[model samples]
Target: MRVSIKDIALKCNLSVSTVSRALNGDYGVKSATRTSVMKVAKELGYVPNIAAKELVSQKSKLIGIILNESDGDGEARPAFFELLPHINKTLAIFNYRAIIYTINSNSYIRGEITDIINLRNLSGCIVVSVFRENHPIYEDIKSLNNPIVVLESSILTRICSNINTDEVMGGYMATRYLIDNGHKQIGFVNGPQNFEISNERFEGFQKAIEESQLQISDTAIIWSNYTGSGGKDSIHQLIQNNPAITAVFFANDLMAMGAISSMAESGILVPKDISIIGYDGLFVCKYYNPPLASVVIDNAAIGVRAAELLLELINGGSGKTVRVMPKLFEGKSVRKY
Candidate 1:
């Protein structure tokens, strides 16, 4: 019941090879012929057999979307979810499809990534939310023969590309903003110490305080998980230990929101009792009781750029690195002193 390329060739009164070339938009096919073939193929309701195409070309058109299981129960980060649509749209332009694979972080060992690629015959991959630095998976991905683009983690190879936001500058901007507003006793709530972004941001925070000649107290910094509950717990612990702190910088928006909610329950108000700044520039920040001030990363741009880089790699291009800059989104949460 399905129309085939042969059927189109028969209707157009052309050789099967000529029809194939025209349908594929291959070189040597005249523009008029290609247009005619496409129009006729559309009239006949022809659907491409991707499986057959793969068999003939010996290359799958499938692009693997890899995520770490540790990011939480198969659901990707909010930032990653924001990036997905752009990545998918870009891939569709190249006639490629995305297939998601959640790598188990807890039980992962070396060589598993290579096995997955071989089994799927994937044309390329986009890895997201992998936090560990020296994990076996990184080593495996480095040695893979196929093209790959990693988000947030830096792993460069002949076949792989890396992309991330400029986290150090983001951190510095957030801290310096607080310092400029006259908040001398500032606290910093960071994610886990193992994450490279966390360390970079902390360095930025330290730089801002040092430049301002403000004392850095050990009790003013807390390293916690990148979760709302973790943020709530961290704020309470931070305030209890350093009651003189007049402002805080949270590494992410979720934690910042959690801290705000927790502080509200304790009769403390943001920008009134204490000022706050957050990272990740989540859209929901605009709707919060007091709009959140954050360092916003361009998720859409990152997604599109990642897709373009992966396509280039798949087409035999060499690896490269891309770092996007972050912008400060001023909101009502930060009170000007």
Candidate 2:
């Protein structure tokens, strides 16, 4: 009961071969004839056989999207989740479908990534995960022929194409924001080792410290996971190390919430005895008891842009790097000093 190209050909009074060429916009067909065929095809609501087209073109019209989960946890930062909707939005405009490749792996093996990528007949791939400066997988990806766009990678010289936010600047912004408000004894909670974003943000913290000429002894910094529980633990350690510390800057909002709750349990009030600032402008931050001040990074934009960048490589975009910057949000948590 459905319509076919042959049926359209018969209705248009054209040979089947000619109709096929016109529908495909083949070189031999005249523009006028092609337009006429397309007109009829539209009027008939003709849906071309995509499988047949793939056979002829040998292209899947599918792009590979790699989700590189960091921190060895199933939890993806709220910003990373934001990127997914934007990537889907951008791909919709290009008529290209995404083939998700999960890199929720802790092995850090090149073969794992290579095997997963080859399993799908993808025209191109976009790698989204937090990797360090000397990861072996970077070399392996560079050896492959497929176009790749890596997200949140700091080492641009080795990779073909990459897109990431200015994390160091983000770190600097968060720390400086605290410093600008006249808080001299500022405390900082650091993230785990080897993740590039952590290091960059750490550098930014140092930059602010350097500019202020503030002496941050070893006791002022406590390294921990970017989770709320980690933040809660780090606060105890930080306070134990430097009891006089009056303000704290948590690398992520999860830790900030933990610190806020723990402080309240012990008869401490935010910005009264201590001020707190956090990162990742998640929507949930707005509802906190004393709304959290944070660094606003557009995770959705990163996701969407990363997708578009991969598409360009598939359809013929030159290799290049993209960067996004983070901004600050002034919430109720920070008190004016």
Candidate 3:
């Protein structure tokens, strides 16, 4: 049986109007009366009707989580899986709900995103995708009045804020570790050049090489999609063209794991013939035969910060960008010279 406000009002010997105001935290209800109503409502296990509340308040209290399928081939990576639950839990604490919306990079046209938000009546939204500066969605995003938070991209609008792991730092940390181990002939397997993260990480890689005074050949760098197969292809190309390469850095763990198998198939032993390290400290890395070394991006922190920022924006706060630092997880994948 559902417990309604009418039942509580009757028990309290009060009118329905008085009970409604108190239940909704509206002004004019005495503290004692509000407390009594809440206590009785809890005892009766009352669940507020969200539709009714929204109708009365003219607010949806619903948040949209928009993700772009950048890889468009339908192979979705679980990169944001850990981060989303945290965001949902944080929003729930404030009586808000999260709805997921996916956009395909290949199919998404201009103004499509704006239509989703307006039609869904979302109070605000968080976007997680790999978008180049020239992506058409930015025009739609910039014109929105609602609050928005974007993860892992450089796009920022007056109403849109950004949250990301410190990609440059993560890249530098991974590469410097290889350098410290005395690997001079290092190769880099990065993601598609269109993604901002791929470029930022490469910047860090360049910084580390410059600081170490190591001269890396132009042929040593390769770009691919953030997929296992892409990693395998890139590593094979990187090594076959630059056989002097003694170690390599992958922009993601999936690619790193793929490269390991590719090397084994080619009769090259990891850390013995060629050393390697990866990014994205996925838990599965520790279980690998050689244990992958990676820079851990704290997705939990990003989720919490993103939720907070969205709430802040809904409440009329100004938008701002936030960056969480990545930590290095050392493993046995790299060999010391």
> How would you encode candidate 2's per-residue C-alpha lDDT over 1-337 as one tens digit per residue?
7778898898889999899867754434566888788899999999998788878877676667776665435555566566677877776554567777776446767677677666766666777666555777777777766767887774343325788888888889999999999888989997776667778778999999999999887888877778788888899889888988878888889888889999899888887888999987888888997989998887887887787667666645566888788889888898877
The regions of model 3 sitting more than 4 angstroms off are: 1-49, 70-72
Clashing residue pairs in candidate 2 (N, C-alpha, C atoms within 3 angstroms): none
Candidate 3 weakest lDDT stretch, 10 residues: 69-78
lDDT of candidate 3 over 175-200, digit per residue (tens):
99999999999999998888889999
For each candidate, how many residue pairs have backbone atoms clashing (under 3 Å)? 0, 0, 0
| Residue 197 alpha-carbon offset, candidate 1, angstroms | 1.3
Model 1 lDDT tens row, 1-337: 9998999999999999999867754434577888898999999999888678889977687888998877633434678788889999988765678888878877897787777778889888999775567677888888888899998887899889999899889999999999888899999999888777889889989889999999968999999777888789999999999999999999999889889999999999999999999999988888898999999989999999999899888867899999999999989899976
lDDT of each: 0.87, 0.78, 0.86
Q: For candidate 3, report its TM-score.
A: 0.87
* TM-score for each model: 0.87, 0.83, 0.87
The alpha-carbon deviation from the true structure for residue 269 of candidate 3, after best TM-score superposition, in angstroms, is: 2.0
- Model 1 scores what on Cα lDDT? 0.87
For model 2, what is the alpha-carbon lDDT of residue 109?
Answer: 74
- CA shift at 230, candidate 1, in angstroms? 0.9
